[model samples]
Target chain A: MKSETVSTLLVEAASLLAIGMVFVFLFLALLIAAINLIAAFCRKFPGNFPAESSSVPLTKPLATPSRKIDDTTLAVIGAAVHQYRKQHQSNVKD
Target chain B: MDKFDVLWQSTALAHFTLGQMAMMLVGLLLLYLAIVKKFEPLLLLPIGFGALLTNIPLAGFSQAGGILFYIYEVGIDTGVFPLLIFMGVGAMTDFGALIANPRMLLLGAAAQFGIFATLFGAIALNWVPGFSFSLQDASAIAIIGGADGPTAIFLASKLAPELLGAIAVAAYSYMALVPIIQPPIMKALTTPEERKIEMEQLREVSQREKIIFPIAVLLLTILFLPAATPLVGMFCLGNLMRECGVVERLNKTAQNELINIVTIFLGLAVGSKLSADKFLTVETLGILALGAIAFGIGTATGVLMAKLMSRVSSRKINPLIGAAGVSAVPMAARVVNKVGLEANPHNFLLMHAMGPNVAGVLGSAVAAGVLLALVG
Candidate 1:
């Protein structure tokens, strides 16, 4: 209500601003240290991380497997088998 | 003659005041900004429409028995809606960038200079005969610098409900203007070389560390600043649900459905505050001016802090990312990235800027806590 109170409040605000900034920096600094520590620990004990088997396992992930036969190739293979079977049946019938 | 009299009485013309008409026009302007300009449309659209509804004379939309009134009573008045939104934000946020480069927290802290600086600015306006801002009023007004709408609304609801309309409007307006407000100051503070600097790529954070991060932050908050528990607590809850990878359902609800519902109610509640009597004051104009100044000062301080850090710290930080420390989330980060690209085509500062962007959220939350503890 008084001018004195108003001035006191402003003074308090200034102090709090300074204190708040320091706390923010300090709190985050601690978090930074914690993060760095965790990173170092993870690097040191990589085995503690989930094994490939425990997580997603891609077998021969980088390896290129032999190309599978195309539809045309499969059709050709089927036609040859059918022709051979038909000729053998004809011979038996003769 | 009696029938004509009843019709005239029923019409808006019979009940409208100059202030109400002006507020209605303002509401339409906000709608135009949201729909056509795509400025924070999710919020401004509803807020604008709510303003329109509230300004209608015969419709008791903002009165005791009205839907908007109940929404305000249950949510904004009790400060629940903002907390729910914070939780959603926490769920949606990825703190990995922040965790990987925790030092960006200093930029976040530096950006809050706008808040404290504007406190003095708001109080000093008392010298102008028509304006007088108490400490509580000043605290509520200054948080517009935080650039987080929910935090501003939360603090205003707690400290100064009367100014909620102007404060919320100013906060969101400045947040939407981040693309325009931050760049020139960011450019002025740093050399072209500093803007062009490329930061190192962040390390991959572990799932374990990600899961633990929110819990650790909550523990720290409880130990030091319990007043912030309402905001930080809900935020951490959302973040933990997201990171834990166990509560997919709860996380989905928090970040998406739950948040969407709360946003609608929150917008309308805020709009209800934009009544003709409340928003038509000289103080509202002062708030708008102070809000812009706060954002500019915040942008300037963040860049300066980065420049200071660059000299002392061994690691190189592109000062452009410092502007993202104002906590407008991905928008501020994108602005930094755009500015960085202009200086050096090869530099992509989005991910780097994100570190400070999220840290700014935490920093502002902490700053709000300090203000609440001291002033509220």
Candidate 2:
């Protein structure tokens, strides 16, 4: 009706929007902080999930076992070791 | 002169002259970039073809109720095309990395500073001859900084439909060139040591968090930015289809068929706007220059924010990854990884950089909302 009344309504609407925005910002800031907190926890202790736990035991099997050597192969290894030890002993004595 | 005039008059059925033929060759070059170079082939191919059609003088492709014209009306003019494309992007995007590293949100938000900065650059460009851009038009054109095609198309649809072709072209072109444009700035900003900073392995984001994120973001949009919800809502819808794990059919269709189909229509619609009278102008050059400035500013802001957080966190964050904050998705992330490898062959920042890359997508959509609110 009157210009003053319309202006008053407009002012009220603006204020409402501002207040609404502030609240939205605060809520989002908190939610983001919460997500960051959870992600930080997850990073520190990852295998709490079953999937992450499954990936860990995979690399453990790579440690090869000690095996008995063939006679010829063992003789070659022993001769090479003997030569290496003799050189080390000479160097140490010097 | 008389002989030449007689010969020219004798040349009937000659629809295209030499200059028009050259422009057509330029269109062919763009097509090569699309098909062979794979520079966003889905859009670029259609756009290059449309450019050729529009420049053909008497081609009825741009006339009333023509295919391109109808597509423009149904999609681009109504702003539905970009929104639908956002759905595909959301379905394809992985927010897991950003969720794993929440602090990357800061980088994502910081990257938007360039968007606003270029708005000013666009307005100031009006001081030059043959370039006249209003504030709203400048705001619309400057969104190419996001490097997101749909967002560029979205804003242009609202503020400057006449400028859509240029904005979309700049956005997609720079996107394809992110590998070229970003590395120098990233290298200049950080030392070899900073680039070599090995990021800790990203923690796995849970299925629950992954599923909830899109919903949360959609709710946030509903509350904070209703103007952006049309684009963001469809985006979340597509992401929900993906993350829910039950809608494999919808996810497949949205990501593959629906998106590809819409991209052709959208590109053709946008390309149809590239008539010589509308496109070959000083204003288009201004838009291109402003887009570059927008992209540069967005990149610089991301790096600066990353640097700031590094001090605050007491652990090093690779500032190079921050350059991915311009919404180029995997391309920006790949660029970060590539540049990081140049510094230290050991470092792999692709997955880590993806956090800001995707988050920047959301940030730019939010920026688009702000523009719609302020301008619409």
Candidate 3:
């Protein structure tokens, strides 16, 4: 009776091995097609659906000119640059 | 004298059995491995501690009303912890590599041959007098070949709760040993020229494709094999959250906080099953041996499959990356990269390996679903 049980289990396991491998292969094969189809669709309609703003664009320029700088802003920037250079020069001399 | 006697009888020392002592020693060995060797410390540490707690004489930690009992009941018994872990894994995984190269999915599929082949090994073990595994027990045992800890635990809990501890331990241990276990097989299968082969860079995948990939996977799984939906569904949900570029907070929580919490619970629950009666069996030896074989066969098949692909395709593929198809995640991929570098200093296969690494994850989940459908 015990040997009989083991034999049946071996048979069942053998069948499962065949069925499981085939299904897994078939399922993944279908997934590969589906993925390719999705890729093709996206290629056809690029950026039709933008990712949320949370995604920072990898290639975005570090700075963009949203508006022209005013004269006062430019003067402020020029003064900050002068001050920074003066401090660095003084430290190097020291 | 009477009061002293009562105190003595209540002490753990008084109730200790040889089995409990042996089990506690096993727990300490696990702790040593986790702390000293740092083998999957995240899960092994908690599991080791849980084993100690469960084996303490008169503690009843794994009994009806204990903390370990409740944790096991809430998480592993209900099969929630592994699913939650899968979600977090999904959230953390970047499908870009896979999306860039869909053909790598075949390597992933090829690796799952380990799981099914081990089913035969497990059933054949029944010929031994001490090992009489039911079809379900064999099924649970075979998943260890998947080399995926969560998938193994999930299937083991469902099909053979009694064997969960051995199966989980074997799965994680082999996964940790992938660096050691896979290299020799990888070396034996491929030639030096093949190992040094460099393929073209993967095309940049669009965010739109990433967003659609998980949904397509889930849809196919649901349509054809609803049984696998639980594992595949949660995985897709996590991936969708990651790729959709919305629900950043939810995605972050799933990736970090939620997964960590569940891993702790899952580890402990799995450890609770390591009590004396459940663990001290001849069957555990069979399980550990079988788990190692599963990994070896899976690695061999993956490498062989890649060799076949390399032969057919105009573009060359380094057969080493095929070993990553067993889904030890970045670890398996890194091993492939390291081996490839040895053959040719200029070759870098990390990104290429990641495609099959992640594919192996889905492949194992699908395989688990098949086992469940057929045997459960």
Candidate 4:
């Protein structure tokens, strides 16, 4: 359908359409700039940010002062860690 | 008898209406989005393919005893897909923020004002030339404002199966265009200061509370709106699986395999409804118009409700997050976050908006249930 053929209701909305699209384009351009900046910063600080290490499992924090570890509990925890490692390895493979 | 038979020999000829051709092309565009643009490919791709399949002349995929019709009977007409997907959604949702901030429920309710208002608008639009929307059809079209695709389809299948194709397509397409359609509305509704206002850090939520919250909510909704129990029940079940921490297997399946499979079948079944005879009329345009109006009203209501809450409380809330209360999931919430960042880069509204975001999903389902109860 031609733009002129659009109904009066839609024609009234044309101003909104124009204004919304302009803002969207500007937002995209700024997003691209920000991504480029991030890439540059990553290059500048090569090893400073440990993105991968932050998500590592925490086993050492509460255990040393909290309780005496039973063999069964230790085994269960060990099994959980082993499963996590396997899951992680498979994800990396994918 | 032989001479008569020779005179009336049938040759197979595919008959498709102009509207069917248009809808088929639109289906192809959806496929392009799914395959190339990679936009909601999991659901859109299957739906697009289904559209293509069912639109082919004499395919009978949607006819008596056919696969598409059978699937519709099992999943959609019975309202199974929406409830099952709700379960998956509940499993995936984190209700800590919502629990900590109960005020967001009002925003959720405010967003649904769009559904009822659009119902009236859609019914009114029938007065337009060539447009003839029944009460059921208008109600189906109006759910698009709720911005919940599954709920829209669920209600359409039950309340107005004839309009299902238009309603579902409009709902999903608008949802895909949320990032484009919503930011302007969000920006226009709130001032720079309101958008910039940073909320205090949400209080920490315990595992115990997380586990109990779903149960409490389920019980409450069941007692108050037994009509909504079906959806709320499935959702609570899904959440229970996730929070109980013992059903990782079920949780994984619900989120990944079950919802994905149902989405494909559901998409195709919905596409079947878009046959030329049903879709090409002025009613489709009215439906599209009503959908946009519904979304606008929903967004505006959410923002205005948030503004109201701000007046009553000392803790300043960014009214822009209310736009997320229309149940577009993370998409509407993400739009709120993006628009907020535009005004103030430091402001983050994603988690806070999630309270209303998920609530919008529930609210729409309840609204759908109400419509179904009254109109079914």
lDDT of each: 0.87, 0.79, 0.91, 0.74
Top TM-score model: 3
Candidate 1 per-residue lDDT, tens place, B322-351, comes to: 888989988999999999999999999999
Pick by TM-score: 3 or 4, better one: 3
| Candidate number that wins on DockQ, 1 or 3 | 3
Q: Candidate 3, clashing residue pairs?
A: none
Pairs with backbone N, CA or C atoms under 3 Å apart (clashes), candidate 4 = none
What RMSD value applies to candidate 4? 13.9
Q: How does model 1 do on interface RMSD, in angstroms?
A: 4.2
Candidate 4 lDDT for residue B213: 62
Tens digits of per-residue lDDT for model 2, A1-94 = 3445444534443443344334333444554786766556655765533333312332346666658778999899999999999999999999
Residue A54, model 2: lDDT of: 17
Cα lDDT, model 3, residue B69: 98
Docking class of 4: incorrect
* TM values, all candidates: 0.89, 0.79, 0.94, 0.76
- Across B206-302, the per-residue lDDT of candidate 4 in tens digits comes to 4555566677667655654576678778888888777666566787788788877777787777776767778777778888888888899889988
Q: Write the residue-wise lDDT of candidate 3 on A1-94 in tens digits.
A: 2888888888888999899988888888888888889989988888757655447544559787668899999999999999999999999999
Model 2 misses residue A60 by how many Å?
A: 35
Ranking by DockQ: 3, 1, 2, 4
Top-scoring candidate (lDDT): 3
